[model samples]
Target: MCQTLRQKHNLTVRRQDVMLMMADLDPVGIEQRSRRRFVRRVYHSLGPNHVWHVDGYDKLKPYGLAISGCIDGYSRKVMWLVCGASNNDPDIIAHHYLQCASEFGVIPKLLRTDCGTENGTMAAIHCSLRSTHTDDLAGASSHMYGSSVTNQRIESWWSYFRKQNVLQKDLDECKEIWNTHTIRAVNQSRCPSGKPDAMYALPHRFNGRECGFCISQENLNEFFVELTRSTCGDGQLQAHFEELHAQSNLTTSYTWEAGVENYITLKNMAHI
Candidate 1:
């Protein structure tokens, strides 16, 4: 309305003034929450891949699908969104993290998440990367890993996810839709092309925040081997492990026994 008035009527009005005028015109129509006043807060990150926020959404539980996703802290690019039958399953969460790292050469320096049990596998994977985990307390419903206000970047996307009315469809299709959909740059650091995938590839456009950390091929193989152990049988996993190492030219110095021990240690420490 402010822009329309300025463009059409040679009238200048501030956006907040226009909002107040609208509120007076239809007081009941205005949301009470919107009317509340608070100091505006700003959030910033050092750079992309410096931190990532990962979480799961289970609103589609009645339809038997749950969504897990990660978003870069700085550029606000969504790293990946993975869907499965159970978002709470540790393996499902770990698989999505692994998949994101596979596509992007670097791993995040830090991951922030709530202390829900669903994050167990993701936390384990983050620790495996020698990355730090910043967590909200377990069962602390009011606490968010970072401030609730700061975490709004991805949480706001969930609102649009429901508005699109795509929740009832199959998981794979929903994942595809989200991955391809273009988001315009609301800030300067966002992709010039306004697509997450494009911005992800062109880090220079966002001030050189891309590909900061690369996981070794041997470590990648070990991670998947540990990840696939119970999920897939020994023969199939062995073949995959060897293939990954050979493809990446990584020396296979880490043993499966050591991987198991590392996983167990991380899991136990995560709870305490």
Candidate 2:
């Protein structure tokens, strides 16, 4: 009778429901508590540009591609995706970074990556960026100069991508198909929190115009400076400001100063 019931009336369980049932069965209760704690930790660490997660994938044969993926920790958008063999090459990572900046027009404030050989080679790209090593009391300056931010959001995204998309059959054709489908799905899908989609603009009711507007340089500068100086200190925001200053060919001090000046000028001009 039990066997017949098990076979005929088996539960169609969702992942969360299974987890809840398991928690109810756990004798010590530690498993459920620990899992909850772990999830909360992950949620607390997420922020836009807070961390970038990267890994290499080789499940697809013949081509044997190595992939590095970057995700926006806050918006959960895939910021950068690059595929190539030779896991340890910095060029691959750099190429992806450039592609992201060109397409998205934003630079990540913090890059979170695993301790891979390619990611470990900080010298080449560090020199290219012209960021000087400071002799602060900290250990080797390399540690201070190179990308140091780390988080688990990227890892979670990787697990979802692997199980839901990458690890499916048809390994040969999965890359192109998965990339196109996943990106489109993510860009269009609404977040569970009811937040607006990050990739596209919201529709303005008055004019039916897309609400997305290019952030003016003057406003951007002021916003970043205020972010840096404000009490809600975020490392990712600081990193973004630095990256933008570098890209704009302005010194860090000059960037902040100019931003303030520009904001004032714009406001004054508006008054006229």
Candidate 3:
């Protein structure tokens, strides 16, 4: 609070004063109870893209909407956050990973995700690409799977997600806020406190390094071909989805409300 005021308004108030004012303004938030946990896990990451944590947020699943995301373990930058119809689908989740890698033109040295069946396709793709390299984190070792709760970085972030909002637009706006917001330093932690996007873009500024690996253009193309086959049902499903979209009267301009409305309409039409 103090830093934000100083940076934006050129005000120099003590931290305590700012805290008190904020407390009065948001008493419920200030008095919010902390969740009790058994352990405080201390983790280490070599740098941005050293490890990418991927997970599914299911709070909206009951509404026929799904959210999937990936975060940088080192800088806590949200690599991607997407809302879709079925996060449990292997191809859908894999598409998220592939899309992110293509956009950034790089993949993490290692990927971490829970051992859910939905991650099977993503794991295969990561290993297949990493196999081209001869690094220690290549091949089948490119991804790790374990319990979802143990994927602490993204797990904790989901709690904040629950408190804030629940839509694709909300998720996108929240992701922007998260990337630009300053993080507070914690004791015994090597990760520096700073805006996530800045830390990721300039790792050296925070005594960190980049561990991203470049993707070969040929492999990227081939993978896209394979992904289309797996996810698009050989173009028939793609055409059918387009028909449904048109029937639902949805435009390219999307919102959570409209998406749910479309889903419900389709469900009713399908007699499901």
User: Which residue window of length 10 is worst by lDDT in model 2?
Assistant: 223-232
Shift in Å, residue 236, candidate 2: 44
Off by over 4 Å in 3: 1-18, 25-38, 225-272
> How high is the CA lDDT of each candidate model?
0.58, 0.40, 0.81
Which candidate, 2 or 3, has the higher lDDT? Answer: 3
Higher-TM-score candidate of 1 and 3: 3
Q: Write the per-residue lDDT of candidate 3 for residues 62-129, one digit (tens) a residue.
A: 77568899999889999999876678889888888888999888999999999999999889999999
Report RMSD (Å) for each prediction in the order shown. 16.1, 22.4, 4.9
lDDT string for model 1 (1-272, tens) is 45446644568788789888988897875876455555544545556676678777778666444677777766557777765556676777777777777777677766777667767666776675663323332222212355433565567557655644333243334444444445654432333434455555666775656534676666665666344333323466546555554555333324434445544554354443
Write the residue-wise lDDT of candidate 2 on 1-118 in tens digits: 1222233346454556655666677746655545544323324222344334555554543433355666654445555544444444655555555555446554333444556666
Best by lDDT: 3
Q: How many steric overlaps does candidate 1 have?
A: 0
| lDDT at residue 232 of model 2 (Cα atoms) | 15
Task: Put the candidates in TM-score order, highest first.
Answer: 3, 1, 2
